[model samples]
Structures are given as C-alpha cells and as structure tokens.
Target chain A: MTQSVAMTINGRRREDHVEPRLLLVHYLREVAGLTGTHIACDTSQCGACTVLIDGEAVKSCSVFTVQANGRQVTTIEGLAEDGVLHPVQQAFWNEHGLQCGFCTPGFIMAAAYLLKQNPSPTDEEIERGLEGNLCRCTGYENIRKAVRSASQAMNGTAAEPSAQLVGSAAAPVED
Target chain B: MITAPFEYARPGSVDETQSLLNKYGSDAKVIAGGQSLIPLMRLRLSQPTALIDIQGIPGLNEVRRDNGSVEIGALVRHVDIQRNAMLRESLPILVEMSNDVGDNQVRNLGTIGGVIAHGDAAGDYNAAALMLDAEIITNKRRHQARDFYRDIFTTALEHDEVVTAVRFPVSTGRFAYTKFRRRLYDWAIAGVAVQETGSSWRVGYVNLATTPRRGSAVEAALAGGASAADAAAQSGSDIDPTSDVRATAEYKRHLTQVLTVRTLQKATMAA
Candidate 1:
C-alpha cells in the first residue's frame, strides 16, 4: 500500500504515491531522481543524506517520506542558482573541501545550514556544527576551512561566533 | 535503510491519535520527532506496524507559561527549545543541554517529549527533567518524572497513550548539564545535571543506571556543608555505574564524581 504525499522539493511541487515506510533519502534518490543527496551510512550517523527541510538541515535517511509530505525540501542538487554555485558550494570548491567527493554534498549542505545559523562561526564552532557529517577521507582541515570561507563569503565579515554558542567545542570529536 | 512496512497516519488532534493507537494496539507507535525511533527502525531493531505521527497536532509546539510552571509541548523540537527565547531566559540549562544533543540536524527534528518517551539513559534531557522535578503530562494523566522511567529505553507510557507536554516548575535558578562523551555528537558516557530549587539542590545522573537516578545522598551531603569534593564523593550512594563500551564501572564512578564536582561548582557559582 502507498500513501499519496505532495511536497515542494527545491521549489518545485512534487507529488508521489510512496510506501509508508520509504525514507526521505530514498524518495529523493529513487522517486525524485535527485541522487545528489547521498546515503553513505544509511543510518543517521554519517549525515551523508543531509538536506534542508523547511530551511533546516535534517538527515533525510531518518525521516520517512510521509513525514515530509507538506514540507519544503532543498537537497544538494537544489542549492545552486542558474549557472552559479551557492556560496557554500563555491567555498567548498575554492578551498578543496573534499578528496573523494562522496561526502562533499553532505558537507556543503551542512555548511550551508551552519552558515545560515551562525554566519560568523569560529573554527571550533564550525567543527562542532558539522560533527554529524563525517569525511572518511580525513580531510577535515579543508572542510573546516571551507566552512570558514563560506561564512566570509555569505556574511562578508567573519566576526567571532557568539560567546554563548562557544560550548564543548573543545570537547572530543571521536567516533 | 527503510523502516519495516507500516501504516502511517498524521493525525491532526490527540484524540484522533489515541483512536489510531487503539486500532493498532501494541503494533502502533507514536512518532513525535522520530529521531531515536527511526534510527532504530532502520536497523530493524524496532519494527512497528503502524506509525502515529503527531506532528500535525497543532498547539503542541510552543513553550508557554501556565500557572507556576512552564509547559513545553510534546511536539516541541530540540532546535526550537535551544533557540527559544523563553526557555533561554527561564531555563538556560535546557538551552545548553539542547545545544549538545546529537547534532544540529538531530536537534532540528528531535523533540523533548520523544526523548522522554524513548528514555535512552544516555540522552541529556531525562536527567535534566528529573533533576528539575518536572512533570510528564500525557493524554491520560500526569506522571511524575521520578516514576516515569522504568529502565533503559523504557518508560511508563502505554501503547495507547501519548505524551502531551512536560511541565517544569518555573525556574531561573542556577543549573548546569555536563555530558562526558568521546565525540561531539555521541551520547553521554556519564553526565550530571544539577539544579537549585529554592535553597535545596537536586542532582541527577545520566547513564549511571538503567534509569535516570537522582542523588539524594549527594544533595544531603551538600546541605550538610560538605565540600564539593566530599559531596561528589557520595555519588555512588544513589546510583550504580556499570562497565559499558563507553567506560568501565570504576572509571565511570570516578568520572561521575569528578563531573559532579564540576557540575556542582558550575551550578552554585553561577548565582
């Protein structure tokens, strides 16, 4: 049995009859044909399927398609403007954020959300903000740099992150 | 990565949700945020045949002041709590704790009622709620935080019941939540939540036992003018620490004591 769900994906109204158990990540890839949202861990750990639902970053794999029925979803494929890249994507490209590129889309989406939330995050804040998304390539230095660069591009001034948000950033990032 | 095939219903009201739960019985599960349940479902650890999504239930997403307590709706997301000006002003510890939850993405979807319902020992909110003497209000009746937790991953909630809101006594008191974890987004290995209600102190431990345990012995020690170190030395009085993948029993005991000192110092010194 399938449930009819209609949601706006990347500003385009999409309607589909999806199984009740289908994950949002699978719906985006299989049904919507937007494979830019990768699913590396499939579990919620890797954040490889991260996307913006209603302008907030969420792990697509953890949300059922029916749950997002009336929401707006913005995947990595929906980030770029006509013939131009989003600031985070451009910063990732400029700073060489990924080596294998498998985790880049997730990183970009996570970074996009982070910049939107804290447009002037410090290095430690960036690290804490993107901890959900992992890079098996161990290219975190560049990823952090890419986020730092993204903040500069979007806000035009990279002031220090607010003192309140500066928490447990000194804490470990181990698995 | 998909949950087991299930029937889905997005009920617009709690009454409709209760009816769906009655129709599905034990096979039905209430999904508020689905952060914890969906992950388990993807791993096939939990395979509920029916999902009762309570997101469409309106008026359950706000943190409002009612009488002498603050009422946080069951559908209030962690992200909302973290960024909520009301909670940040009245219950700053919750904002701090909410910020340290799984991650930004997890916070964006996870809800306080869901966390309380899931009852993961490592989750941050259970200890906070217990330490604050919060009340768990369900569709059926009000349950005290002390009796709501049965065990790890277990709560007093019935299959046909759903949490409607959590009532925390209005407090701008000094409090601190310190979670010890190996990773930024990882669950707490052992954490402490200390909140001051009037002249007394309530201390709660996270992941120290099968349930969130409050340390009355530590509180008594504090009341008796025991030093921070001495009060924290009584941490083992109320809770039992176990050897887990995070740390050994002895290490968790020691860490709990040390963390208790830090948590206490943070709580008292704040005001």
Candidate 2:
C-alpha cells in the first residue's frame, strides 16, 4: 500500500503518496524532480545519494521516503540561495573538485553539512568527514583541497580560483 | 531496487509500538532510522510483512545519566551518541566505537539499538556494548550486554520484544578499540575492544566468530598476571573465525592478536 508522506524540501512543503518501500533518493529524484541528488551506487557503499535531513547528512538510499515524513530535507539543489552558489559549491568550482561531475553534488552537500558543523576542520577532519564519498576519477587531492577551500571560504578567506581553473583545464587538455 | 510490499504503522508512543509488535509478532519489524534494515529490505534478505516505524515515538531518543549509569534510548542515533557530552565523558569507548560505525551519513541514519539488535558480527556497536558491560533493556525482558548477543543476526530479543533503552554503568577506567578494515566504511575483518578496570582488563573480539565474544583466554592470561603482549597472543585461542572475502581465518587470527595487543597497550597507557 502507498502511504502519504509530507516533508519540507528546500523551504517548500511537499506531499506525495509513496510506496512504503520507496527509497528517499527515488522520492527526491522522481517525485520532487530534484535530480541534483544523484544515485551513483545502489548500495549504501556510495555516498552519491547524500542529503541533509534535519540539518544532518544522511544516505538517502538507506532511508525510506515514509520514514522522512515531517522532516526537513535539503538536497544539493537547495544548497544555494538567492541566485548565489553556496560556499561549498563555489569552493568545488574554485578548487576543481569535480572530474566527470557525477559525484560533485553529493560531495558538495556532504561538505556543506560538514562545514556548517565544523567551520574550521583540520585536514584529518576533512578526510574523516569525506570518507564516505568515493570519486573514481579525481584521485581525491582536489576534493580534499576543495573541502579545505570551502572551509576557508565559509570562514571569509576565499582561495585563489584561477590556480585551480588552470589545473582543471590543463588536465582535460592533457587527456 | 523495490522493497517487498509491507504494511506501515507510525506509532506515537512506546506502549503503542509494543502493542503493534504484539499484534504482528515476527511478521513485523521495528524500524528506527532504517540504516541497516532498509538496505536489507532492498536486497530482499528481510521481507517482513509490516514495519512499525518507532521514530515518531517520544522519549525514546534521549541519552541521559541516571543514578550511576548512562541510559541511552533505543532510538538514539549514532551521531547523537558520538556528540553527546555525557556519553563522551562517561563512556568514550562508545563514542569512539560510534565514530567507526559506517561514515557520517550512515552514523547519522543508524541508531545504536538498531545496530545492536541487528546483531551483525562485524557491527561496531556489539563490541562496544560488550566491552562496556551495558544492559539491553527491552519491553519484554532486560538482558546484560554480554547476554544480549546470541549469534550472528540473532539476539536475546523475543519475536514480539523491542529494545527500549540501554544502560551503561559509569566507570573511571580506560578503554580502547582497534579494528582492521580494508576501507573507511567497510566492516572490520577482525577487531578488539579492551577495557581496563581497577586491576583487571576485559577483552572483547569482533568478526572473529559468528558472534561478538569475549577473549576469554586472553582475559584469563591477563588475570593470571601474564604480560599484556603474552595475554593478547591468546586472543583467538578460544574462538573460531571464518574466512570471508575480507580476509582468511589465519589472517583474521593474526589481526585479532595484533589488534588485541595494541588495544590492551593503549588502554593500559590511558589508565
């Protein structure tokens, strides 16, 4: 049987009739049409389906839509506000954190939540914070840099964007 | 992946949850956070006909100090336990174990009671609970932490029972946890938790057998005044480990020895 579940998503209250078995990732992608949250691995091993539920990061695929009723969910699409990129998204762009971009949104959401909780995370904290997310292409040096840059940017000291732009551009050109 | 069709009920109170469980019996599964069970459902490994969603129940998500023990509600999320000041101060072993449980997302979604009740041998919570000598309080019966685990994926919980809270006695001792894993989020091939009391040490081992078991041989050797390194060598002597994709039995035995010694030394130094 389908159950009616309601939640506040990105400042908007939404209601949908979902199967008790419907995963929160599918609900966000299909019912809410928020495709910014990608599902890279169907298993819980991949953090590509990460989102902020009640201001905490959680694996959307591991949660049922019905279980999320009455909660606040913020996907990668909701990270930005007022036509400006969130500090995490901007940091990823500034640090060249994405390769194929499949894992960017999840990393951005996870990093945003991490920075919100820890505005000045150390390199070890950043590594532990992003341990769940897997990037097959970028080799993680840029992701780690992006997380540090995002932490700094959130603390009002933004990094130089041009250096990473050159690096990102040069890598694809070399390929 | 679609989960098997199941009925759903969101209970508002623990009494209501107990009644639902009594009604549905084994056909129903109690879902709190759904980090482990949902994945199992998606794989069709568990096909319960109904799920009693207890996340809405009040008074079941608190971590409070009572008398001489810290009481943790069954619905308390791992992240909450990890950040709880009292739990961190009183039972940091639990906090450290919670930190190693999956990653941030999994910890945020997984509940301590769910992890313990799920009873996976590789689960981090089982080792911590065993090491801390916590008590698993259920609606039907209360069990000592050591008596709660019966086997892999099996607990002392009755078909109609639900874990309400867990109580861990406060101690001024030192503890340490060491696990050997291939990746950050992967399960440990073998792990050890050491708790040093006034003059004795309690050792627990994980992923070395079908259930979380005390390293009785090591504990006995330590109690007999053997050196920590020599005692730790007997870590897997009393238990049978299985070979899985993660590691062979011989490798797991070796890891148990190494991790046991390291954990014991760390706990001793902390003491």
Candidate 3:
C-alpha cells in the first residue's frame, strides 16, 4: 500500500506517495534523488547509509520512509552552504581521509554529527563515536585524523591545510 | 532491497496497539524503533502481514523509578537509557551495556523492549537484563527474567501480548559487562556480565548458547565463598554453546572463564 508522507529534506519541504515497505535509504536515493547516501550492506552493520535526522545521525537503511514523516533530514549534499564545504567535508579532503572514497560521505556525515555533540572528542571518543562506520580502504588512521582535524577546523583554529602539510603545493611552478 | 508488502498502523495508545494486535493476531508485528525488526523484515526472516508501529504510543517511552525498581518503558530508546541519570545511578550495568550495543546510530534508534523481545542470544541487553534480574512487563502479564527466554529468537510473549516496560531492581552493588566481538558493534562471540549484590555475586553469559543464561554454577560457587578464579572455572558448566563462524564451543567456553574472571575483578574494583 502507498501512503502520502511529508518531510523536510535538505532544507526543502517534500511530500510524496511512498510504499509502506520503502526504506528511507531508497526514498532518499531514488525518490528524492539524493544519491550521496549509499547502501554498503543489506544488514545494519555497515554505516554507509548514515544521515542526519533532527540534527542526530542515524542509519537511513534501518528506517522506513513512512516513519520519517514531518521529520527533518540532512543528507551529505546538504552539508555545504553557499558553495563552501562544511568543516568536516573540508577536513576529510585535506587530511587525505579517503583512498577509495566509497565510505567518505558516510564518515563525514557521522563525524559532522559527532562533532556537533562533542566538539573536542578524545581519540577514544572519536573511536567510539565512529564505531558504527567501517572503512576497508584507509584502515581508519586517516579517517581518525580527519575527524580530529575537522574538530579543530570547526573550532576556527585555522591549522595548516592538509595539502600543504603533505608537501603537495597547489600552485604551478614558474619555469 | 524491498520488504514484503504489509499493512501499517501507527497506534497512538497502548490500548489501540493491543487491539490491533488482537485484530491481526499472529499476522501482526509490533515495531517500536524498527532497529531490529526492520532488518529482519527486509531479509524476509520475518514476514508479518501488518506492522503495528508503537513509536507514538503514549506512556511507553518513559524511564522512571517505581517501587524501588527502575521501570524502563519498552519504547525507551537505547540513547535515552544511556543518558538517563536514574538508570545510570541505579543500574549502571544497563548503561554500560547500552553503550556497547551496535553503535551510536543503532542506540539512537533501537528500543530496549525491541531488543529484549527479539530474544537474540547474542544481544547485549539480554545478558544485562538477565544479570540484573529484570522483570519483563507486558500488557497481559509480567515475566521474570529467568523465565523470559524460550530459545533463540523466541520469548515468553503471547501472541497478542505487548511488552510495555522492563523493571530492574536498583542496585547499590557493583556490576560490569565484557563482550568479545570481532569488530565494534558486532554481536559478541562470547560475553559475560558479573554483578555483586551485597556479598553475593551473579554471572550471566551471552553468545554462549541459544539463549542468554546465567552461570549458575559460578554464582553458586561464588556464593559458597569460592575465589574468583575457582568460580570462573565453572562458567561453562551450565551451557552447551555451539561452534559457529565466530568461535568454537570450546573457545567460547574458554572465553566464558576469561571474561568471567575479568568481569568479576572489574565488579569487585567498582565495589
């Protein structure tokens, strides 16, 4: 059976007819065409489908679209405003957080919510906060660094950019 | 992946939910937070014809102290339980167990009632509840912790029965829970929860069998004034755990002893 549900996604109010069995991940990826939320595992073990609901991070795959009626959802695409990447996104890019990039968006979204709740998370806190997310490519060393860097960046300390720290200058050499 | 087609009802009250359950009978499934049931539905492990969404039900999401026990509403999410000061002070074991369940996202969306009612042997809440001697309160009746589980994925819940709350005695003693899992948020290969009530200690084992069960022999030995190591040796005397992809029964038995010793030491330190 299909039911009409209304929700606010990425700052826009949306109303649609959805099947009672449609998962929120499918609704976000297909119906809403916000494909940044990826489904890495059918089981709830993988955190690849993480999204922000009412400013708290949750696994979209585990939720039904009907249950999200009148709720606020923030996807990866909604992180940036006015062409500027959110601090966590920028940190991930600068810290070399992603090698394959499949898990970056979910990690970024989860970290963004974590930082909101805990601005100065210890290494152990970061480990526990991001325990739901799994990344096979980078082995999580870079991801942890990225989260710490993002936490600093969000606090506006203005540390050295990731590219310069890694000895890769963006400007072309004059010959 | 698509879930099987099903009728859905968002009941506003417990009476409405009970009536829906009575109407649908065996064909209906009660969903609190949809943390566990939704995954099962999508996997076709459970194909209920109708879903009675109880998320909006009143009086089912509270955590309050009543009659010297902590009454946790069935719909109380794990996140709420972890943060509840009363629960933290009264039953810190539950708070510790909640912190280790799945992860932050799962804890935010998962409900205590859903976890216990699902009756997965590997579930951390089951072990914690069993160790604390929690009462599983339902719409029809209340079941004691020892009598709650029938087998893996099976409980004492009647066809139309709905769990409204769980009640655990406020503990002044120390308690600790230790789970060994391959990865964070994964089900335990084997885990142990040890609680010291006054001078007596009780131990509960998880993932050591088809249902969470107490290490009665260890508890007996402890009550008999046995040393922690001596009591830990009897950890697997009451369980017949299966060898699965996670670990061998022998390995789990060994982990039972190891975890029991460690947990008891931790509980003692807390005491």
iRMS values for every prediction: 0.9, 0.9, 1.0
What candidate 2 gets wrong by more than 4 Å, as runs, is A159-175
TM-score of chain B of each: 0.97, 0.96, 0.97
> Which lDDT values do the candidates have, in the order given?
0.87, 0.84, 0.86
Task: Give lDDT tens digits, candidate 2, residues B173-252.
Answer: 88898877888888888888877767787787777788888777998999999988899788767568988888788988
lDDT of 1 by residue, B225-254 (tens): 899899999998878888988789999999
Choose the strongest candidate by DockQ: 2
In terms of lDDT, model 3 sits at 0.86
How would you encode candidate 3's per-residue C-alpha lDDT over A32-130 as one tens digit per residue?
999999999868777999998888889999999988887999999898776567778777777788888888788989999899989999999999999
- Model 2 misses residue B172 by how many Å? 2.4
- The estimated TM-scores of all candidates read 0.94, 0.95, 0.94
List ranges where model 1 is wrong by over 4 Å: A157-175
- lDDT (tens digit, per residue) of candidate 2 on A1-175: 7899999999899988989888899999999999989998888887999999999999899888898999999998787666466777767777788899888888888888888889999999998998889997855898989889878767867656643443344333210
lDDT of 3 by residue, B1-271 (tens): 6789998888888888889999998989998788889988888988999988888878889899967899999999888988889888888888988888888899888999998889988888887778778999998898998899998899999878889999988875788889889888888888888877877877888888899988889999989989899989987686779999888888888888888889889888875
Model 3 chain A worst lDDT run, 10 consecutive residues: A166-175
